[model samples]
Structure formats: C-alpha cells, structure tokens
Target: MAKRRITQETFDAAVRENMEEFEMASEEALREAVEQFESQGVDLTCIVKAVAAVSSEDTPEESTHEVLQALDSLRIGDNSASVTEVEADMKRFTEHCLVGFAQRFLAAQKDAYPVILSHCKKSVEEPEALVNALSALAALTNGQPDLLEAEGKQLFLDVLKKHREDPSVTCVAVRTVRHCCLKHEQNRQDLVKGGVLPLLTGAVTQHSESAALVKEASAALRVMCYDDDIRATFGNAHEHAKSIVLEHKGLKVLIQAAKTHFEDTSVLSELCATLSRLAVRNEFCQDICDLGGLKLMMTLLADSYETAELVRQVLSALRALAGNDDVKDAVVNAGGVQYIVIAMNRHMNNAAVCEQGCGCLSVLALRKPENCQVIMENGGALAAVQAMKTHTNSLNVQNQACMLMRNLVARMPQYSQPILDMGAEALIAQALLTHQYIADVGKAALRDLGCQVELRELWTGEHGSLSY
Candidate 1:
C-alpha cells in the first residue's frame, strides 16, 4: 500500500505550532513535527524540513519570511488601487527569492506563482513594474519549473512579444522563460511553437552590445535545444536543434555574438558552448566552418589558453565541427592541432580541457592518416599521455585518452613505439583494470598498439551453455 503525503504548508504550520504554543527550540520543534507526521504514516519527503524565518518585529504577525509577507501584500490589494505598490512588492519578492532555493521552494508551496504572475499581467504597460514582476517570476520559478503550466507559459511568450523592443524587460523575460522550460518538455515545445526561437535570436541581434541580455537570451536559446524532461520518450531535442540552425540561423547569430563579446571570456564560453550544441548535422558543421566560426574558435583558443573554461568550450566546438571530413582537414590546415596541444599542455590540471582536447584529436584523426600525422607531429600524442597521467581519477579523461591513443596508432602503427616509450602502456592497463565500462575501447586500443591484451568469450555455439 502507498503511504499518504501531506502538503508542505501543513507540516510547516505544525512546526510553527510546536515552536509557538509549546515554546520549544527550533530544532526540537522540527524534530517533533517530523516524528509526529511519520507516526501518522504521512510522508514528508517533499517538505522543506525547516522552521520558517522570523517575521520582522514591526509586523507583529505569525512568524513568516519577508517573501511570504510580500506575497500576502499583493494578494490583499485591489488591482486598481494598488498599481503603485506592485513594483515595490514585486521587487521585494524577487529579492527574497534570490536569497536561496529553500525560500523559492517555500514560496512556491504558498502559491506564489499565480500571485506574482498576476502582477506580470497587470503591469504590462508599466515597464519598471513589468521588469520587476518578470524578474520576480523568474526567481520564483528557478527550482520549481512546474509552476509554468499552460497559462503561465502563454503569459511568458506574450510578455516577450509585447516587450520585444525593451531589452531590460526582454532580458528578464527570456531568463524567466529559461527557468520554466528547463525540465519541462511541454513548455519547451509550446514556447518554440509560439515563435520563441526568433524572439531569442532577435534579442541577441538587437541587444548585441548588452552582454547581460545576450547571455540571458543565448542561455534561453540553448535551453530550447535540451531534451531533458525525464517523462519524454525520445524527445524532440534533435528537431529543436535543427530548427535553431535551419529555421533561425542559430549558427550565424551565436558566432557573431561571440565576436561582439570577444574580450569577454564568460560570454564567449557561453556562445561557443551553444554553437557546439547547434552543430547537430554534417552540413551545419560545414556551415560553421564557412561562417568563420573556425577562425573565431581558433582565435579564442589561442588567446584564452590561460582560461580553462573558454579553452574547454572552444575545444568542444572544434570537436563537434570536426565530425565532418572537410572540417577535419580544415581544422588541421588552420594549425588547430598545435593550438589544441598547447592549450592542453597549459591547462594540464583542468580535467575538462584535457578531456575535450583529446576528444578533438580523436575525432580529427578518425580514418584520416594524414590528420593523424599532424596530431602526432604537433605533440598531440604526448599531450594526451600527460593528460592521462595527470587526471588519473577522471574517467572521461582516461576514456578520451585511450580513444585518442587508439586513433593515433590505428592507421599509422609506426607511431606505436614512441607512444609506448612515453609510458602509455601502464596508464592504459591501469585504466582498463580500474574502470569496467572502458574495457571495450581500452582493450581495443591496447590490441591495436601491438600490446598483449586478454580477450574473453562469453558464449559459444553450444545449447544452453555460456563461457567467460
């Protein structure tokens, strides 16, 4: 039988009663409330499991957070008479939600979504209040994505359409859209069908100079490409990614945005990562190369060697683009191999850079012997070996390293001695023993490199018989 569950409000109210009526300590009250609820077979997994913050002394109300107080203020006001107080009330609510996740979760349990969204509907004509209301909504929906259902999501799109020219309002509105659509597949599809891709890219184009707006808008655009809703069965992530590239020209918009914020590594990282996500097709990869994305990526890689995050993202984009045969050659011809090696050597301690760097080489050297020579000549093999040795704890780094090693020696077996001389055998063997999942690739890498590897058979042509 299924145990019954109680609302968070009920549990919190009981805790407050314990603290106020029995004059118990906050800790004792919380423990007692938890014990009492469980004794009655009421599940409390969804509850926040904490005492409410004390209300300010001047209020003389029951103990409540400032966020809830502000919520009550807006709930009791007459829409026509309290127009002026909406902005301040929304700002106050937004500030409290920003304090932490617990506050946001608590506020959501108190039905803050409709209360705050009502302000968004009422203040559409007032820019300041609208922005404040949108900002508050964005914050309140941060961890509570289910709050943005049919009505809330439509209002979000409507806000974007109504305030298209207002960058300030659009920035917060896009942010709100991102927060709501994060784990909700239905919201993502609905927003995309409502022309959100164009609005997001247009925001990037219109506010190219505003890093804040571009960052928010770019993040929202990337969120559209996610297929993260667990309930979805084979989600529309690929279709959405294709739409952003074909229907909306996402590649050109993101690359141009990266150029505008070239000096800003933070923005460049976001844009490059987005570009990688959008590179879902072979022609799209070529499109990125033709659109000067390769040049921009190389330049960023060269200039941002010291910035581990930017370097990691650039290498990731390069790795994605190199999926095309032509782009692989183009990457090698443009001195990309050497740049990647240098970045890996520079940020050897950063597991992500090393992993992505090895992945780039692994892709570039796939079935292309000439590109393999370029990778080996440019210290690609040595960088990968060092990465394997440095980040022994990182399975991704180890896996990518083994894969790169396999690619390097797969076509050109002559390079095997030098790689072995670099002490790859020990690392590869240790990795094969340490991690079970990498056994297939790691064993294949060892075998191709002319090293002795154990091969096991699990089945034979005997009825009802298994062998290991």
Candidate 2:
C-alpha cells in the first residue's frame, strides 16, 4: 500500500472536522487522524499543532492518552532523522504536556530503557545528534529516577568521561546527572562515589565563558552538596568535600565564574549556594574570606531585597565567616554591618533571613566592642531587637536575638546607655518573660542598661522575692 501525500488542505480539513466534533470525537477518531497524518508523511509538528488546535481545553484524559500513544507509534528514527527533527519532536511532546504521560507509557514497556539507551549510545558518536539525544534522554528520564538509576546513570557517566573535553556534551551530561540525583539521595551518593564532583568542577573551570555550562555544572554541584551527609564533611572536624574542592582549586574557579558572569543570577545563586555549603566549616570560612568571599557575599547582600534565597545563602556564609575576628573586621570594613542591618529590616518577615542575619550580627558582636558600636550606630541593635519582637514566637530568632544583646551588654557596657535609650530594658524583660532559659542573660543585659530597678521588679514579680 502506497502512503498518502498530506497537503495543507487535507490537514486543515482534518482539523476543522475534529473541532466541529471536538466533544463528540471518540478516541477512535483521534487515533484515525494521527494514522492519517502519519500515512500522509505530515511532519509531527504539523500533526501536533493540528491536534492542539482541535483539542478543547477540557479534552478527555482518554483522548489525550490516545493522542500520546498515536504519536509514540510513529517511526521517528533515532539516527536517521536530523537532530533538529528529534529535538523538535521532544520539545513538541513536552509542549503538548505529554512528557509525564510518556514516562508512564515507557514505564509499562519493559524494553523502553534499553531502546532509549541504544539510541543514546549511538547518538554520542555523532556530535550534533549526541547533544540532541542527550537532551532527549534527559527529558525522557526526568522525574523517572528508577529508569535512570536502572539504565541511564552509567551511560551518562560514560558520556561525561568520554566527552569531558567537549563543553556541549559535558553540559548536557552534567544536567542529566543533576536530574538523576534530584530527590534521590542514593543517586547523589552514588554519583559522589563515582567521582562526579571533579568532572562537574572541571566543567565550571574550563567552561567559564559558557554560562549555560557553568550554570548547569554549578547547579549539579549544588545538588550534590545538598545532602546532609556530604555537607557534614565541611564542618570543623571534617573537611572532606572542602579538601577536594580546594585541592582542585575549586573555590577560585567558583569565584571566577561568579565574577565572570556576575549578571547570571541562576549561576550566581547556585554558585553562591555551593560556596555557602562549603563554607560551613571554620577552616573553609577562612578559606572563603581569603578568596574574597566576603566581597561577593556583601555584594549579593546589597541586592538582598530582590533575591531572597541568594540573600539567605549569603547570610549563612557570612555568619560562618564572621566567626573569625579578622573576617568580621573585614566584613565591617566592607560595610557589612550596615548591609546586615538593612537585610534584617528589608526582609523582616522572612524568618530564615532574620535568623541568619541575627546569627551573623551575634558573631560580629562577640568579644568585639567596636563591632557592637558599629552595630549600634548603624541601627543593628534596633534591628536585632525588632527581629525578636517581630518573631517573638520563633525560638531560633529569640535565642539569636538574646545572644546578640547578651554579647553587646557583656562586651561593651558603655553601649548599654544607647541600648536603654532604645527601650532595651523592656525588650530584655519581655524576652526574659518569654524565654526563661535566657532569663539570666537578659537580666544581665538589663543590669548593664542601669535598669536594676526594673530587673529587681522583674525578678521580684516572677519569684516573689528581692533576694538578688
């Protein structure tokens, strides 16, 4: 039997007929239309467009499934078709909201993974097809981790190693790996064990000019470092991840990527997030500061209002860095105290931001009377007090706020007068009344504020005694 030739008129007529019987069109009618279009050699794009045009917004689930099945039945060659064709088909399926349905379809077919893997393996030999196939594989396996873990993981890793020098292939491979590990902790651990980190970090360094590559690579690293087990290695006692990163001079690579593509917020966000995770340890904090992490973080904090998560990560990194006196001073010299105060006030409603902001201020105020003065002059004290008052119910915020105030009163008693002028005693008394565990610290702050009368009244009211 000879295949029919499809003309625009034929396509238009089919679309009109489907639209006229949109609600009445049975699954059989939809399947027949797909078969007719395929027999006529109409491009899948045209077929999809025609289907989308005739399909009502409330198209029946059965009809959608039938359309997906019809499209999947087409003999779209993995190797013979132009890369553009394959890419177009993949994008079209996704655009028609069929990827999830396709995954379901593939799951039921036991040989689905082997077929896709076969194409992927061949596509890698042809560079153009390789990118397209890799992209298609990524789309197909996305959110289908079992399929990936079972078949695609080693294939992607092999591609990553074989084409490590090709930026395009490397980018897609890293992105696929990222998709594989997302929401799958075991996959993340396996990737780490398979030495995926070095490849990803290398991508970040070698492809500095390729923002897409850098962004994907950075995103992969961010996910890899997301696990608590992996992140724990960056702690004071464990520097495993940090050691590898710094050993490969990964921090410098990251800092340069951040500087090179300063305007790419996704890259910046992911890169900053990765650096922040690595900066969890004290030694890494100093390493970050040594590599000019403070300046980048402060710059990010300057734009805190526009990017809340970025600001959150920067604050976390800053908190770690501020634990070092020299870094604290450097941060202050960089106008960090003022930025932090602004961040607190700007994002007053965000508890995480508030918690991290107060945490940073607390460290800066510890044993550093000058920092306390800077905080006071810059309204940091009022900000800290306000954080406590606003998030009075948040124990972390309360504890951090109390600790900041405790440091202020303990290290610099002279600043207590200004604090008292700001109604510090009432705040302390409230904190005392609210959090009894910090009652002693709050009471001490009140005494530092020359509020002995109020302190005694608080204790007397609570204990029914003026023993102290």
Candidate 3:
C-alpha cells in the first residue's frame, strides 16, 4: 500500500474528484467499498483524498455540479458502487456536500419532490427507502407545504390510493397525509375526494393496522366533523348521521366489535365518540337510546382508559339522553353517579371529563328524582357545591357544575335542604361574587331550597347561615 499524507490542498482536490466520479459510481462498488471501509476501520484522511480525487474536474462549474450530482445519488440501491464507498465520502468528508446537494436539487428542479414521491411509491419497495422518502417529504413540507407541487400531490395520491392496501404502506400514507396537507384547505379536500376515506376506513376495519394509524385517522375525522360547514360541504355529516344512527345499522357493528375486541381502546374510543356526536340530534338520540347506547357508554366509562376523549364522549351521550327516564335510570343502574362523583372529587382527574360527567348526572337528576338519591349518596352534592365555591377561578368547571346544580335542586326539591346544608349556598355565593352569568344559577338553586337570600334579609339578620 502506498503511504500518502493528505494535506488540505490534497484533501480538497481528492474530494472534488470523487464528487465528479460519484455520478458514474456503481451501487455495487459503493456497497463493497462501504463493507471494506467498515471492516478495516477507514481512515478519515483516505476518505477525503478519495472524495477530492473522485470529484476533481477539468472545470470549476463542472466540479461543483458533479459533486452535487454525486451527493444526490447517495440514495439507496445503486449497484455500481459500495454503499460504504458513498457513506464514507459523505459521512467524514462531505456534509457540506450533502446540504449543497439537497438545496441545489430542490432549487434546480421543481420536479424533485415528485421524483421523491415516485420513489416512495414505486422506486423503492424496500421499507427503509420508503421510510426515508416519506421522511424527506415530511421535512420538505414541514414549513413549506406549498413546496408540494400539483404533480407531487397527484403523485402522492396516486401512490397511496391503491398501494396503501398494505398495512405498512397505509400507515405510512396516513402520516404522509398529515405532512403533505398540514393545514392546506385544498389539499384536505383533495384527500376526501381522492378516495382517502375508503382506504382509511378499510384500514380502520383491519385489525392488523397499527393503533397509531387508526387513531390519527380518527383524530382527523373528529376535526372534520367539528366544522359543521366543512362537513356540510363534503356531505360527510349527513353520512355520519345516516350511518351511525339510522338507516344502515352501523352501531350494531361497533357493539359487536366491542364484545370481541375490547382490548383495542382506539377502536372503542373512536366508535363511542362518533356515536356520541351522532346521538346529539333528536332522532339520533332516540335511536341510540333504543339501541342500548346507555349500556355501551357505561361500558366505555367503566372499562376503557385509552383517552379522556372516550370518557367525555360517554358523558356527553349520557347528558343528551338524560331527558328520558330510562336513560337516567340506566345511568344510575350502571353506577354512573358514584363513578362520576369519584371522578370529580377524589379523582381530580381530567377536568373536561369531570365537567361532562357532572352535566350528565345533573340531567339525570332532572329526569328521575329517584336518581337524585344516587347523586347525594355518592357525594355528588358535595362535589357540585365545592365546584361552585372553589372553582371560581375556572369558568368552565364553575359554569358546568352550577348549571347542573340548578337542575338538581329544581327537579328534586327534597334534596335541596341537604344540598344547602352541604354549604352549597356558600359556593354559589362565592361564584356570584365574580361572574354575573352564574350568579342567577346560585340564586336559583338557593330559591329552590326555599332560602333565597335577599340583601335586605341579610341586613335584617332574620335568616342565619342560609346556604344554597
């Protein structure tokens, strides 16, 4: 072996030459070189010499272009050179080469992304290449989604449209959808119209699809459903109402699935959440109530701990159906009042779920006075009263519990005395001191207990320590 000492001048010249030769390097040669370098513990000086030697060119312009060309070609599966050959070139001697290569490719060719998408979809069957290609798409679109040109978008749509039938590909495609679209309104519409739904739905039905991918799709759907105008524009809300509630018997599928696949919280959460929203309409509510929605929601509350959204969904459904006597009794029968009370007071858990459960319990109290006893027995009165007093700082919790308390005392006046004796009035009065909106709620609950505090009465000292 010739012992060669590498100088800065020698290093630069060798790197420049390697860059030129990179365009002609075989993937096989590259891999072999990589293997050799790894086995022998490659010298950094040798790598620099090789790169400069490979990139050396007769002209400066040609040298830079060839170096960029070689760097760009460092991507997977070229047979003419050893991967080690290319990696050593870039890893030790050519990071600037990598950035310069990427930037030049991005700037010089608007078609670069589409080419990358093509690789992700077709050029590379290897999962590693597919992953890398998808990653590149993510980085390119992270801040400049518009960087995904029309051709690239169509390329992505084409690749994912059919090939995503494979679970791995489908999962990757779901992620790509987020990156490629981000917040682009038109891109989102393209996904809906381009048959992304059926593919997603197909993947959703497949037990083998990753929990994460299904969850991501569910999240996207949840957002889409929230925008009533968008749903109306796409006609998805109508589909939601029709499928989940009525004509097609969709809820049956979920209930059946739940019996066997209880372990998959993602499945149950998405199904229950969808059912909750659909059940908000009057006809849908009656339909869900008829279909044992109460039992299923209770099951979700008791058995699932996947996400707080699942808990909130069950609570929301309970509240929607609370006007029905059967629904309220079902809630009490299901041990909902006790669980909800624990959630609010002792659990100090998710604030959203706590408020929703309270709303449902309040509604239950209004429909069935019998259920009111459950609330009291489970410390519901104390929780509600405490919410009125201590949560004056949190408007959402205060407003929700106060509204529920008003309903509780209004329907079951017999419980009002105990509720007041629990310091309900003190809590209500505290809230009244801050926000006028809930001031009426405090007064109303107090009034229901036959102890409305008139300022004049306070001055008279006729009523001592009367609380809501």
lDDT of 2 by residue, 1-468 (tens): 644445333554565566567643545555767676777665544233334332454643223333343235323455576666665654553343334543333332434455556667877777766776666556655665556664566777778888888999998888878877766666776666677778888888878999899989877776666554342343221333564466667678888899898776777777777776666556667788778777888887786446777777778878877767788899999999989888889889888889888888989988888888898889988988788778877777877777787788787777777777777677767777777787666666666666774444435435455675
Error of 3 at 82 (Å): 10
Candidate 1 lDDT over 1-468, as tens digits, reads 788888666787899789889999999999999999999998675566777776666642456766788888878772644666766777788898888886788788889988888778878898887888889999999977888878887887788888888999999999999999898888899889988899899899988999999999888888888888998886778899999999888889988988899999989988988888888899999999999999999888777889999999999999999999999999999999999999999999999999999999999999999999999888999999999999988999999999999999999999999999999999999998888889999999999999999989778856966799
Better of 1 and 3 by lDDT: 1
Distance from true location, Cα of 17 in model 2, Å? 26
> Which stretches in model 3 have alpha-carbon errors above 4 Å?
1-128, 135-160, 176-190, 228-261, 264-271, 283-293, 303-313, 320-326, 366-370, 388-390, 435-468
TM-score leaderboard ranking: 1, 2, 3
lDDT, candidates in the order shown: 0.88, 0.69, 0.57
* Runs of candidate 1 exceeding 4 Å displacement: 1-62, 78-84, 461-468
What is the lDDT, from 0 to 100, of the residue 463 in candidate 1? 93
Error of 1 at 341 (Å): 1.1
lDDT of 3 by residue, 349-440 (tens): 46676677668777877756677777878888788766555556766666777777777767677777787788777776677777777666
